[model samples]
Target chain A: MNSAYPHWKKGPGPMNSISIAFASGKGGTGKTSLAANFAKFLSHEKNVLLSDLDVEEPNVSIFFPENEKPGSSYNSKITIPEVDLNKCTYCGKCAQKCNFNAIAVYQDKISIFQELCKGCGRCSNICEAGAINLIESEVGKVNEYSSESLEITEGILNTGNIHTKSLITDVKKYRHRDINIYDCPPGTTCPMVESVLDADFTVLVTEPTPFGLHDLSLAVEVMEKLNKKFGVIINKSGDNDHIIEDYCKKGNYDILEKIPFDRTIAEKCGRGEFYYDDENYRIKMNNIYNHITGKIK
Target chain B: MKKIAFASGKGGAGKTSLSMSFHKYAKDNSLFADCDVDAADAFLLLEKEIQHKKPFYSGLKYKIDENKCIQCGKCADSCNFNAIKKTDKYYIEEFSCEGCSLCEDICKYNAIESRSNCCGELFISDTVFNTKMIYARLIPGEDNSGKLVHEVKKIAHEQVLSAEKEFLVIDCPPGIGCPLMAAISGINLLVIIIECSQSGFKDAVRLINLSKKMKIPYITVINKSGLNPDIDNNIEKYLADNEIFSAGKIPFDKEFVYLLNRKKLIIDSDILSGNLKNIFSQIKNRIEMEK
Candidate 1:
């Protein structure tokens, strides 16, 4: 009469190890600051890992001390189709079949532009003679570091490369421990999706403005589709705006926490200082950490 | 025709407000395109009524006929997205289906047939200001946002050409992702709305970097400039370093909330009209030079 799957019997625990992802549909909603402060708050009782998933523009490293070096680093490579000239027939079929226009056929040769390629393998699949083959192309790097109270992992996409999602996927591989915090890239796109897809819970950091309400709805839609638990945190709360609150009510979303707009917090962040040390900010972030942990557990 | 896009990497940076005000100030026959399909709200500010709606279908979804199915499991095995689940009865989860048609190609019994899935609806509307606006609404779980933005832009461009309009103001989706990229494609100029906050400045840099790479002429507008004077200074320095212009700074104004709540453009307010008029004139000059 016992169920075959014992793992399913036990619900999510206090999750002394939990990963709270701070993501926004658009950039500059204070995801990193919220992420860093949340990490600092959780570090008080558990080992925290702050992962900066904005591979294109990593800012988590700037907020930490100068002596910190990532504990380890990993490379992410994407397979881009590289045509073998000897095998190519110059028939122009690959170019004709490619939907992304990555392949081009000239008078006597076929050229592959890696930048335009989506790595979709359409051209390779369409090649009649199997002239096109995918080769490993290094797209980005993931760096891991350990701080006094937490571990940090950051992904850096090689500038001018379009394969950000692949790099983000590589970064997720480092989430070996529980209680991880992911700092998602701004925007509702493939890279953001890559960072957030695996999280058990997400914290949508937003300001109280029309634009904030607009993008928060998009992020909320993504969470709902993924069937992941989430709550809203109104950063810069005292702006005297009700757009977010109205949205929360309309959508039946929980408002987990609110952080008032403080210039000191901004100054500290600009100076590369952790603002979580500030008693007031720490208290609010701790409440958020506890709330998320409570729900996930 | 002049096409200008208002984009910001970070959300809540005032792209919509600025775009709406520009649409009002231009007063020259113009088409407003809300290219932020995920959350199209420029219409809300303009109090527009959707006059026409069209469903957007990105690709076709293959449906397997249970009557014709032989338990071969080839269709499930061939799906790269793991969209098909094999059980007593085979089925496809619409959300996971990318519409690659691999399942249809692999089905030996010819049981699978492809059908279009409705991602969202695109709208052509008439605003209270009497201007034509093009926008889209994406279903919560819809895919192909980039495709939707492209569709919206196409309609907006057609409207502009037919009306002999002088401008097309696009309120782009936040972030430099596929949707934002699609919104910026073929635009004459990009106005990046930046807020005076640490993350705001950081995102502005990211968006500007993307604009530079795309070879799109762009300028920065620091919204809510009075919030953090220090952060504003940092953004100015960053813009200077990048050789981008600080088009004009809009101070934090309570009237913005009032205007939005009333579903009216800021330029339409009698008290704020002068200020918005000046701001629009400056933006128009800058955009004209870029053209």
Candidate 2:
């Protein structure tokens, strides 16, 4: 089924096809909106792929119409330790060796709490009687969908699970297109980092409030440490004030774009309006897209 | 010390704004902890200088000594995280590993050695507000964010108690993940900031539900209320329906950016100080009322 795309076997696109990641340390800062619009803007000129790496809450699909389906895809699995009671000696070694306390050994048998399980498989390995085995558990689903404008792929992390980085890594295995725009999860943690780490550039979306400045700095620090090129996009731009610009000056970062706080835009989003439907917002996004492409070129 | 955490399950709702405003209102030697270590941002507003930093180690990585002649696929097969892959030669992706040490424990040839990976760094910095800010950073593709959140909160609590400060205001991370849970653990109070949007309202409801389940007393702060006053009304109605107290509503103000650009808190501005004072007084009354 994966044979339709030959580039999938050749490894991700060439280095010339710059990858831009839209990230924010704080949630609700318009990272997804920026990513969706930026993808729309870039699709006009380049072969773009909008990879929604925010697996925990995949919302990028909401930006598109209901008919849109992610193109070629793959299902990823993680190893879950399973115990076979028939071959069990009930020695309690598996429970004792498990560090996460996922396994509880009673007098006669053992129980495993799947939520707390890191899928380490120590229990199966330590089972002296070969009573335990490793089983593949569905952790996430990766979907690749294409539109007339862009190819979109997203990873949906299974609910009640915490291993987002692994799921993101699995989804990234399918990133074979150029000009990839990764919509990263909010926060400066493992999952967010996993989404933005390999990208050639990152666009930090923040509002011009105290909190926005605060989180933007953290995201900038992460990008700086990773040595990835990044710029700031102040969402709700004209609403807050100049704190973001002052922050840019102090931090030596540039304000790539300022998206004014538009009620129409929010209303459109709430109503599920596409980017092109709002011509003014689309123009703004296009300018930002051009700015990014110009910088990269 | 009153340790109040500003948290919301939904991202971009204005948790940072409330925390920053609270920091401005209670600006006396208090410890401002950016417990949203995954995205610590309070330091940016404070213009703080990092005074001390320490690497946070969460889990271990198992390194195989190839010289030990352990081509046994047992270790590779033992890891559930898919950290290990057999490709002619055995290779382990450090980011994928959960540091379970199962590979080392199962290696019969004693070739695997487990070592801790520095997930990120924790910083104790001096902010422009003259307060000590406690924050941490989690490296991308690393685990144990809950542990890091706990460590930073502990440090903030210790500082607050030692200094006899009035408040330990914290900026919490987004979502209901381990980090958010850790941020909410053992806090004196929680202020959930909710934006007036469908997803924001939904996430705020989830946060309030979680707070009730955890028995954490919380209040609501609706930001960007002017974006759509009707939506704000619905959120207010939801809060009323849920019996959650409303702290105050911050109108979508353009001047907020002016304050931010100047690196000044809104509470410090003459125009917004009166409103901020009213909000702080309400917060104080709410806490006292709860007590």
Candidate 3:
């Protein structure tokens, strides 16, 4: 039965299988819960990898308790420039070349905001004098937890650290095998863009309310700008909230699925579990997986 | 003046609605700022027209001068972000570049130049409730959200001085990331609004840990209460274990959402207003004590 579903593989080519990212401009519409449950649901038939790119607050790993016993973790480091005062020429070339404003030069001293430096190597490369040197600093960690068929790879940003985008990119270094589901961070910021930009298909999880409608529009605009194929999945649909449907009809967007608003489901969410214990949603997920893989072909 | 910000690491944890009620009930000369620039909704609920707007320039970004490029491919090789690309001609992918200037550093031919990019816009407005509010919006696919958050706060402070407000209530974006940090930096108090759900507790803990690290005086007010008795008890136990003082709690209500959709504050219109008003004042007293 697991093999009954077709793998989202490209024919004799170098396509990195199928990667689907779940994103929403607004937070707390159950993006993590949906991603977590759907990842397990798809793993029943597919080699699914759930990567939590919401480094600031990764909740997907909360659902995978079996894989909780001390997984192999690695640190993420960024090589920021450390200036050598002895070899310094106050040429101000390095200061002018830094786009992040991480460097500023005065008549007597040069000031650098270390956290602002992205270690892009420009400061070192542009230094006319041999003053700038790069030093690696551990900023975040990427951990891999596997149990049976499912694997959860989460990017955990160290507090007071501001390298979310780069660490999110680093977390993707673990992507291998069939289908990869990236649980992206909320908002349409650069970090979310980085995670959802190159996917085969994207699932924009939204609820049917005014806030949902507003943020969904922003997410839609981003997906359109990236030229990526995407559809909407209303996570907490209720009878009164038709704002999402009204806009989707006007924009002619494809709605993948609508998980009706259920109190039991939400309570289950609180417990890091899905509400429906039966195969009701498994069949729905199968349809989604089939449609996306079919689109790839 | 005492400044307070409401931040929950998880979204939809009742930041904006709670801020509105707190501002109304706090009854001080309050300046409300929405640092949730990623998805500002306090304005939506305020039902106010934009009083003022200005483009926010984060910093300088570089672009290739297709004319000066020798297609040496050297800048692309030196680039760590893989921003420099080659198709018809070598061009810089705007979003990919972290504005590191390494490309310009490596370009010996002087083909790359830098200029200010409009990363976002800051706005000044007043709520129908007669409270002054300042908010900002980050343009889609733009970088430097943390910088924009700072700009919004700066405007908020300026507004506070000019308007002679005594209290500053900031509505922060979800997450313990840079934006929320910028929103609450050097504030008088940190009033965290925690929802009593399991995910809510998990998300709130991340932010609580952040506040503890920043060494800010803080309190917690649980929202969406009476959802499930078992979950609620667990939340209370966790709050007690952490010794994070609970200010008050608001029972879950559906009418609140319907009213919010219409841009109305529940504190003024709903039957739950009495309970919410009580919670707001209790939270207000805690702020006063902290102040």
DockQ of 1: 0.22
Per residue, candidate 1 scores C-alpha lDDT tens digits across B68-105 of 99978877775544578876799987655655555665
Worst 10 residues of 1 chain B by lDDT: B96-105
In model 1, the runs with Cα more than 4 Å from the true position are A1-17, A24-29, A55-62, A65-67, A71-75, A90-116, A157-162, A186-192, A207-218, A238-252, A261-275, B60-114, B226-231, B252-276
Better of 2 and 3 by lDDT: 3
Fraction of true inter-chain Cα contacts (below 8 Å) kept per model? 0.18, 0.47, 0.65
Per-residue lDDT value at A170 in model 2: 73
Error of 2 at B206 (Å): 3.6
* Per-residue alpha-carbon lDDT of candidate 2 for residues B1-291, written as tens digits (9 for 90 to 100): 677888877776667767877887777745788887776666767746888989887777777788984687887775656668777778776655677787788777888888777888888888786778889887744678888999999888887898788788888888765678788878878888887766677567767777777788898878767676667788988888868888888776656657766667777788777876887778766765653
TM-score of 3: 0.93
- Whole-model lDDT, model 1: 0.75
- Comparing to the true complex, what docking class would candidate 3 get? medium
Model 3 agreement with the true structure over B134-189: per-residue lDDT tens digits: 99889877788888988888888888998887888999998887788888888878
Task: Please give, for residues A1-297, the per-residue lDDT of candidate 3 as tens digits.
Answer: 001102223333224667889999999988898888888887877788889999988888667666745567777778887889999988888888777788999987999897777778778887878899987777788888875677788989888778888888777765555888899999998888988866788899998777788889988988888888988898877775578878889999888888877777766786777643557777777777776776667
The interface root-mean-square deviation of each model, in the order shown, is 6.7, 4.2, 5.5
Worst 10 residues of 2 chain B by lDDT: B282-291
Candidate-wise lDDT, in order: 0.75, 0.76, 0.81
